[model samples]
Target chain A: MRRLINRHPSRRMKILLGALPFILAVAIYAIAADARGADGPDKLMPGLNAITSAMSRLMFDIDRATGARLFWADTWASLARLGVGLGISAVIGLGLGVPVGFIPCLRALFEPFFAALSLIPPLAVLPILFILFGLGELSKTVLIVFGIAPFILRDVMLRVAEIPREQIVKAQTLGASSWQMILGLVLPQVFARLISSVRLSLGAAWLFVIAAEAITAEAGLGYRIFLVRRYLAMDVILPYVLWITLLAFAMDYALRQAHDAIPWTRFKEGG
Target chain B: MMAVIRLDNVSKSYGETVVLENVSLTIEDNEFLAVVGPSGAGKTTLLRMLLSQEAPSSGRILIDDAPIAAEPMPDRGVVFQRYSVLPHRTVIRNVMTGPEWLAAPFTGRVMGRARAALKSRARNMLDRVGLGDHATLYPAQLSGGQQQRLAIAQALMMNPKVLLLDEPFGALDPATRRAMHRLVLGLWAEHKMTVVMITHDLSEAFHLGTRVVAVEKRRHDPHAPHRYGSVITTDFDAKPRLARQIARAPA
Candidate 1:
């Protein structure tokens, strides 16, 4: 028999091992909920049935006030804000980062400033953004952009700088002009890297969006989660948290797929 | 033979450190000039000077009796030991890049019939380099030898008057290096381009060069190593021997 440290699980065993903790947690929750008793006025831990029923209502039923399915509406609103904010950030990152990385003058002028800017805690600026843009969707969107754009920009600049000097020299020999080098040579490589940067920053982006929404918003996952907290609505809150986790996971998985699809990013330099 | 490239007492120094000092040489048209030296002997610096990627601190480098351009241009193409080909582009796209940039300077791409023509030409060049079947494959997908072949095809696409190679086979295995030697000799003969290749291998220098030149420090100061820079120490005419060998082998 192999030592415990040396033992490697087979595929089926790996899956079973992976699932053990989740099953144990659910069983523990069920046992705890039973101990607390099913009939209760102020139960801290909601039963599985209670959470499921709450989720079904959120999924299938229409809200009396808005006459809209609240969960999807919140998801749509959150996704829209995330998409717009990330799209603008990508454009800015590509536009500024490429030139900053490629041109020595620009790099000298802006690199330190941008590096300083990236260090500023983006959450610290939320109130300022609110004061400037007001408590509308713009403030939340701006918060997401402000939070992640600098990170993406820095990643892109580093990536552009990391492009082997030989390729640049080779391009120059091939008669590529400055603009042609940026557009044809640097841009494609930088753009592929931008997707990866965005994927990494998605967590931070989500945090900012949620924080902004929690502070002030009529709709969104964060708003819903925060709004029901006063009543100790653990059932809705638990499911909503799970849903957010699921969404974040799906996004990360999708971006990984997209990054892999490029076919060249997997290989290291000099390939 | 008329001289295609002439370096007139060229000296390159970075502040207190000198890399090459008072180096003078002339390369005739369609000549294969192989440069060999130990590391830090400025062999690559010499090749870079010819390619116009570096400037001489004192003297002038002339191409066809005119001063070479400050920057590398389509007139000279280069292949380095690594990262010569763009990793993101497919093999065919890499070959077409030079022509495309030449035709459409701003866009870096040609359209319709022009693009088709460039593609066909690129295909032919790839076939010449034995990479025709791997047109759509990215550089990362290629082996080292195949990538070098792609790089050669890419350089040849420009129809450069002078081709600069900086240890192009330095990273390859022995068998692959031999195969590349044959390919490069065939291309040099067929294209009739003035070639300046830098190598560490003396045998390779003799095998591929019409003229094999060694760059080394003529005088050394142990206390101040940077004081004395490398110069062309030995210049040998290998053309006659090469011709005789070719005659015997008939390959």
Candidate 2:
């Protein structure tokens, strides 16, 4: 029923659903390559079929990919990277952004400096990160972390700064200490906005990880797709691309649901 | 009880322009002192100085004979002109915040019996203010009058010795303002806390204050140093007639 349709797909299911396209392309190529023979125009058809067979095959794969072991493992690898990156960013952003935002002199000295630093594309830092950490998980994580943390810090800092001045003064009058002001007055006010910024950073982390994986990884879906591209095996590459899109879609949906679940935002602003 | 607050030779200036000059006043225990002044007068500056949110260029403000210092003294609470209830927390939480923060032992930790007691005191204050039904509601959900009442409850919850208000009803409609005035007066009477409020409305000052302090320009100088007159305290003894007399006087 509608309940079945609305139930959130698991990460494994989403990725398998994504790779279903490659499965169908392989089947189609197997059939066409057998019937038309690679001596004629059949090789060209597989290349064309890689693109056209992708959409319908991905759709069919959504419900059927639940049983694959590698599918689940790849989903976990990507999710673990995302989880670690986002978790680290949230902690660092709150720790740094709150004080920097609330204190005017500190904000004046640092905000512009962070702004200037964030302007450089995160992917461009890959060279420096690899040179420092080499081709390890640390380098990949560092790229994703640096890619996401600055944007989150900037966002949270602005949100903290924009809290109504009256709220701060009111807290002060109520005998809130400096620490209590940050905890009670500032954090609650900025919590929703911070969650949103985290969502954006999470999405950015996923995108950054794909690029990171393609370059240095030998195991992730991005790595698998890059490996397949070497043999002009559109069949494997196309499926992995579809898998990534499905994963992104599912992750975005879950985060949005989490964002909506926040009780303060569920109630309207003036209500 | 001793005079709870004493201000001596207090002067404040924004750059070269003087706001208050050599102003001196003493507030007795449970005294309701309303300060009335024209626009741009230093009434608010004087209140801020008393609260230690601002320091005078010269002179001193003492509470229980101790000078107001950089650190917040638990004996005072201030209600601002704006309705500043945290629009996120419930009314009870907002009311409890003051007492829960300043009271020792519990102040260090907002858990267990301390939190439970805070909830009880906050609920009782809200009930007293007739906002018992709305205790779980946010500040945004309340009417302006209700928010002001909640502000009052919040201030009183701390059991402060001296409560300061800056035009608590200034932004409300006439009917709402009058109702708030009565409500505040009733709370002050019940709690017997020293109250100091600032307002431009002469009638409001006379209606609420045991004594009204008027701030006016004692001298005008187009050039050279400007001099502000000391605060003139008018004891009304809770009489409305004296307010009329002051209002009837020619400018």
Whole-model lDDT values for every prediction: 0.90, 0.75
> What DockQ does candidate 1 score?
0.71
Top candidate (lDDT): 1
What are the interface RMSDs of all the models? Answer: 1.4, 3.3
lDDT tens digits, residues B75-192, model 2? 6777877746776678888888776667643233477887897788778889899899998887777887898898888877767788888888888899988888889888886777
Candidate 2 residue pairs that clash: none
Tens-place lDDT per residue, model 1, A1-271, is 8799998999999999999999998899889987786567335788888888888998889999998899999998888888899989998998999999999999999999999999999889888998999999998888888988999999999999998888999998898998989988999998789999999999988898789889999889999999999988998998888889899999999999999888778876554
Off by over 4 Å in 2: A1-74, A100-121, A221-250, A267-271, B1-3, B103-116, B216-251
Q: Is model 1 an incorrect, acceptable, medium or high docking prediction?
A: medium
The top-ranked prediction according to DockQ is 1
lDDT of 1: 0.90
TM-scores for all candidates: the values are 0.94, 0.76
